[model samples]
Target: MAFTIPEGLHPDLNPLAWMVGTWRGKGRGEYPTIPTFEFAQEVTFNHDGRPFLNYFSRSWIIDAEGEIIRPGASEVGFWRVKEKNVLEVVISHNTGISEGWVGQFDGPKIQLVMDQGYSAPSAKIVTAGVRLYGLVAGELFYAYDMAAEGQELQAHIWSTLERQVD
Candidate 1:
């Protein structure tokens, strides 16, 4: 089913409105020396006529037969059109990484580049990274470019999620 963008929705949110729903998909992820893991994830985006959307995601490793193995969860803070040219997001992962980002929206896509980073709650200083997101053909796509622990920018992860249900 197709989702209908609510009337009076903010123009700055148009590019992201298509993501307001539930999504389920399988993805492949790699980090450091860890083995390439197969994972299934569910992401939900919701809004209530506000300037920003609410985001939540849950992921877990799955075996070849599609059995869940390990679980991971994250909460994402969102903002759009605050001052007319910026889209911001602050994501907090249970794994101890809190990221802050800001970007600009271009037509059907958005390019969010990481602006800063810090430890959760403590808000200690930390290095930054690069992350980007876009919407294409009814799917939301993401790429992470991070430099942590003295490492250089690397393609940490990429995911494509399609709307599943309202």
Candidate 2:
């Protein structure tokens, strides 16, 4: 399907206009500190005539049959695109971890490396991370690798989501 640039989107965000909609899909997650799991997720990227995109994502643990078993992770953030496709992101998780990421986008693909992070007294500290997002076969493919608790960065979660038509 052809994509139309979202009306009123700031010129600076045109490169990311393809992501300005809600997407839904399932993903798998695993970490050295926890067992592998499956989750259903909904992610949205929207803007209000601004230079940045507002991002939100929520997930729920799912059973083998794809039924939601319970709530999973959620995060809120903003994505900003600068000159030369340079990208900056700031995200805060429900678990009290907040991070700053810097990267660049080439066409439909984006690669971000964590620059720093902050954790609350009760939250786990993630020392480093890498996130990859791309448009593949008309779907959004997302993946993340993270280092935390003295462990080296490795695969953590990944998902494929179809854009929702509204």
Candidate 3:
């Protein structure tokens, strides 16, 4: 497929334009501190002809039969072009955790490493994380590894998403 730069998109966001859309997918989650689980996930990246990309994501825990058991983590954030080839993301979670990450974009692949995170005294303390996202053959695939509390960084979530709304 041919890719064209959409008119009216902020020049600063031009390089990250491929990510502007809504994605729906299924993901698996596991951590030493939490039970293994499955979830339905949705993520959106939007732009208003501005310097940053607006971002939002939500997940619902699901049962083996693919039924929603309960709402899981929800996050709102912004992705900005911090340099010619680097992107910065700042996100806040409903669980009272806030994080800042820096990433490098190469072709359709993005690799993000968390620089710092703060957790509310009452919430789980997430120390660090790494997220990898890519667009491959028109599909969105991502994996996340995280270190929290006293545990080492380990694979926590992986998913494949199809663009829902362009």
Q: For candidate 3, lDDT tens digit of each residue in 73-164?
A: 89999999877589899999999999999989987899999999999999999988999999977988989999998999999999889888
Candidate 3 collision pairs: none
Q: Candidates' lDDT values, in order?
A: 0.70, 0.97, 0.91
Clashing pairs in 2: none
lDDT score of residue 114 within candidate 3: 99
Predicted candidate 1, C-alpha RMSD:
2.9
Q: Per-residue lDDT tens digits of candidate 1, residues 54-128?
A: 778888888998799878556566655556556788777766777778887765577777787767654333366
Using TM-score as the measure, what is the rank order of every candidate, best first?
2, 3, 1
TM-score per prediction, in order, is 0.81, 0.99, 0.95
Give the runs in model 3 whose Cα sits over 4 Å from its true position.
none
Q: List the lowest-lDDT window of 10 residues for candidate 2.
A: 1-10
Q: Best candidate, lDDT-wise?
A: 2
